[model samples]
Each structure stands twice: as C-alpha cells, then as structure tokens.
Target: MNATGRQTDLIEDYVAALTAALHGPARVKARMIEEIRDGLADTAAAHTGEGMPYHRAAHQAVQEFGTVEELVPSCQQELTIAQARHTARAVALTAPFLIACWYLAQAADHGHAWLLPRTAQLLAVHLTGVATVAALLAAATLAATGALARRMPTPHRLPLVVAWAGTTASAAMAVTTLAFATVSALTTNWPLLAFAGTLAAASHAAVAASARACRRCSRLPTT
Candidate 1:
C-alpha cells in the first residue's frame, strides 16, 4: 500500500479500537470519536510538516493520542456528565405529562366536580407534591450540569448524585403511579386508565434507560 493508504489504515484501526473500548450515549460517543479523530489528523499533519513520512506521522499521532486505557478516564468523565444530563432531561420532560395523567384520571373520575374520594384526594395531593419536588430536583440537576455549570461550583460527585437521585425519583414516580392507578381503578374510566398507564410506562422506560446510562458511567474509573 501507498504511504497514504497505510496512514489511513493505521488511523482507522486506532480509532476503531478506541471506539470499541468506550461506551456511553451514542451521540456523545460519536462526537468524542470525531473530536479525537480530528486531533489525531491535526497532530499527524504537524508531524508530516516536520519532514516525517505520512505513515510514520500517523504512527506518531496514535502514540501521542495514548492507548484506550489512557484515554478512557477523561473520556469516561465526559460520558458520565452526558449520561447525567440525559437522565435529568428525561425526568424533567416526563414530569408534566405524569402530573397531567393524575389530574386527567381525577377529572374522568369526578366529571366536572373535580373531586376525589377523601383518601384518593389525599394520596393524589401527596403524589403531586412528591412528583413536583422530583421534577424540580431534576431541573436543578440539569441546570447545574449545563447552564449554571460554569457559574456554579459543581460537586465532583455530581454524576453519582444524578445516578442515585434520578433512579430514586423515577422509581418513586413509577411506583406511586401504579399504586394510585390501583386505588383509582374502580372510579377511573378504562380509557383514562389505559392512557395514564401508557404514559407512566413510557416515562418509566425513558427514565430507567437514562438512569442505567448514569449507572454505567458511574462504574467507569475516574480521572
């Protein structure tokens, strides 16, 4: 093969190995790979400019880029942050729909009366309160990881916080929803019950997936 062909093969092999070694959100991982590839290309070009052959420059670039083990710590940190952000976003986005499901079920139960049995009413109120708090926590977590990231002093343990908190909140919401659904089943219409159930299931799935990502990110070695 020509020097250019050999250089391309070497770079591609290195990138493929790196890619196989890391795991995270697909978009975040793809971006990281592209960024690394670009940096490698730039470094190789610099080496070539200094009189090195193309293939030799590619080898030098890969050497400088470090092995998968070496790159993983910093890359995993970014992935962890991405996973945390994803979980927070999932929780924030689903909060309103979940809240609305409860109200909708209540409305279907009482028509225009907008009332529930005393016990149901109390449970609903408490659930709403908890859900609201969880949503707020998620929003705050998102802000801390994003908009307020630079201004705010973020804790080093933020990813772990996100993993545990997000899992708890999401699981709580799911459990509460199932419990409320069971309690209101007799009073709530089948249509609304099905709708609320579907929404709850979807929210749970999204949040669970995000939480799993956060958990995986947490297990990675820290830089």
Candidate 2:
C-alpha cells in the first residue's frame, strides 16, 4: 500500500524467484539475493534527496537499478564456476571407479578369457576417459574466457582465440568418443561405450551453450 511496502514486496518477489532459479549451494543463493537487495537499496538511497513520492521514488530506484534478469546472469556465472569446480573434484574422485567399470565391462564381454591384459585394457579406457574429460574442461575454460572477453572495453582478441580453441577441442572430443564407442559396439557390443560417447557430447553441448549465453550477455551495455 505504501511506498516502502511496495518496494519490499517487489524485492521479496524478485528474491523468491531468484532463489528458485539459481542452481547451487544455498549460501550462494542467499548471497546473491542480499547483493541484489543492496544494489536496489543503494540506487534508492541515491534518489532519496530528490523529493520524489515514496512509491515513485522506489519505482525510479528500481528502474535505475535495472532488472533481476540482468543481474542474475553474473550470479549464474559464479554458480557455473562453482559447479565446474565441483565437477573437477568429482571427476578426480570417481575416475578410478570409471576405470574399474571399464575393465569389468571388458572382462564381462570377453567371457573372462582375459585375452587383452586387464591392466592394458584398463589403461586404454582410462586414457580415453581422461582425454574426454580434458576436452570438456578446455571447452568450459574457453567459454568463460569468451564471456569475459565480451565484457572488456577494448575487445581483446584472446577470448576469441580461447573460444575457437574450445570449440575445436569439444568437437574433436565428441567425435573421438563417438568413433570409439562405435568401434567398441561393433567389435565388443559394449553399451557402456555408447553411454560414454553420449556423455561427452552432452558436455560439449553445455560448453557451447554457456559460451553463447556469455557472448550475448557481454553485448549488453554495462550500467
């Protein structure tokens, strides 16, 4: 009903939507909400001495402060970095398990004959998986770099270089994974190989999507 009440309601709704949309630890979402509120409050404070009505003042404050969508991407970028860090840790932890699964699949397929040395087969599979993971990491890094490049004032050429590198790495990894899976399926009929190929493709797609979003966001003029 009052100006303060209206502003408070708007902030509450915005924060609620943000909390629902952000995907990360609870603390990250809380911090994002607080930062948004402080940004809006600071904008409002700047206009407080202008003698505007409370409702008008708050509306102007929010208008000048910009919308949640604009601010949310920066927060999402931070969340993406956090998630990537988590993925790196998880990859490190579970790599051994994946290696074991590869050997088990190979052994099961071979009727326990042990034609290929188990150690050698495990090493090959580990190398393939590691290469796939490395490609995805390169893609993610390139996408972030591209996004950062778009934000710079002078249009630095390095982000574009990184982006191109990432794209090439992602495509190569996806193709390699698919080819390996196809060969394994035809020779050994291992379905897990197909699954690994799919995972590699999905990771590449995510990196591409992030790069595109970052590029778009970078084009927007800063407040």
Candidate 3:
C-alpha cells in the first residue's frame, strides 16, 4: 500500500478502538467521534509538515491523542449529558399531553355527575399536581444543562440530580395515575371507564418511559 493508504488505515484503527470504548446516544457520540477524527487528522498533517512519513505521522498523532482509557471518561461525560437532556426533554414534552388527557377524562366524568366522591377528586388532583411538578423539574434540568452549565461547577452531578428528580416525579405520577384509573373503573359507567382507563394507560406508559431513561442516567458512572 502507498504511504497515504497506510496512514488512513492507522487512523481508522485508532478511531475504531475509540468508538468501541465509548457508548451513548448515537448522534452525540457520532459527532464527538467526528471531532476526534478531525483533531487527529490535523495533528497528523502537522507532523507530516515537519518531514515525517505519512504513516509515521499518523502513528505519532494517534500516540499523542492518548489511549481509549484516558479519553473514555471525558467522552462518557459528554454522552451522559446528552442523555440527561433527552430524558428531561421527554418529561417536559410528555407531561403536558398526559395532563391534558387526564383533564379530558375528568371533564367527561364531571358531566356524568360521577365525580361526587371526594377521594376520586383528590386522586385526580394529586396526579395532576405530581405530573406538573415533574414537568417543572424537567424544565429546570434543561436550563441547568444549557445556559447554567457554563456557569456551574461540578457539572457531572447535575445529570445524577436530573435522573433522581425525574425518576421520583415520574414514579409518583405513574402510581397516582394508576390509582385514579382503578377508581374510575370501579365507580363509573363502561364508557367513562373505557375513556379514563385508556388515557390513564397512555399516561402511565409515557411516565414509565421517562422514569426508565432517568434511571439509566442515574446509574451512569460519575466523572
């Protein structure tokens, strides 16, 4: 092979190793890997400018770029931040839809005069409040991860905090929604039960998904 081919092979091998060592959301990881590749290419080109052979320059660049072990921690930190952002955004967007579903269900129930019981009313209120809190926490997390991140210290802990807050809020909302659905099914007519139960199930599923994502983020190793 020509010197250029050998140089490309060496660089590709190093990048493959780096890719294997890291994990995260695909788009974020891919962008990071591309940036790394660009840096390596620039360094290699600089070495070649000083009269080194192409392959030798590539090898030197790879060596100077550091091992996967040394780089993985920083890369993982970025990936974790992306994941936290995704989880927070999911919660923020989904919460409002779920709240609207519950509202519609409540409205329908009220029209039937079936919402007379205080306990049912309380459960509906509790679920709505919990979902609202979760959405607000999610919004705060987005801000923390965005503009506030530049000003904040120990940014690694932010993801953990995001995970914990999201999980708790999602879990509370899911459980409360389940209870509300159970109450609706027992106390209302078949049509009302079907409507409420369907909405509740969708809401439960959405909250559970957010909770799972947050749980995974929480488990990520801190830098």
The global C-alpha lDDT for each of the candidates, from Candidate 1 onward, is 0.78, 0.52, 0.73
Show model 1 residue runs off by greater than 4 Å: 1-5, 111-126, 176-185
Off by over 4 Å in 2: 1-3, 93-223
**Candidate 3, residue 59: CA error in Å?**
1.7
Candidates' TM-scores? 0.84, 0.44, 0.77
Model 3 spans with C-alpha error above 4 angstroms: 1-6, 115-119, 169-214
List, residue by residue over 69-155, the lDDT tens digit for candidate 2.
Answer: 776666665654444434333333333333444454465456544334564455456555664564455445445544653775323
Which predicted model would earn the best lDDT? 1
Query: How many clashes in candidate 2?
Result: 0
Per-structure clash totals for the candidates = 0, 0, 0
Q: Residue by residue across 25-55, what tens digits does model 3's lDDT show? A: 6788899999999999999999989999888
- What shift in Å separates residue 35 of candidate 3 from its native position after superposition? 1.1
Evaluated at residue 22, the lDDT of candidate 3 is 72
True lDDT of residue 59, candidate 3: 93
What clash pairs does model 3 have?
A: none
Ranking by lDDT: 1, 3, 2
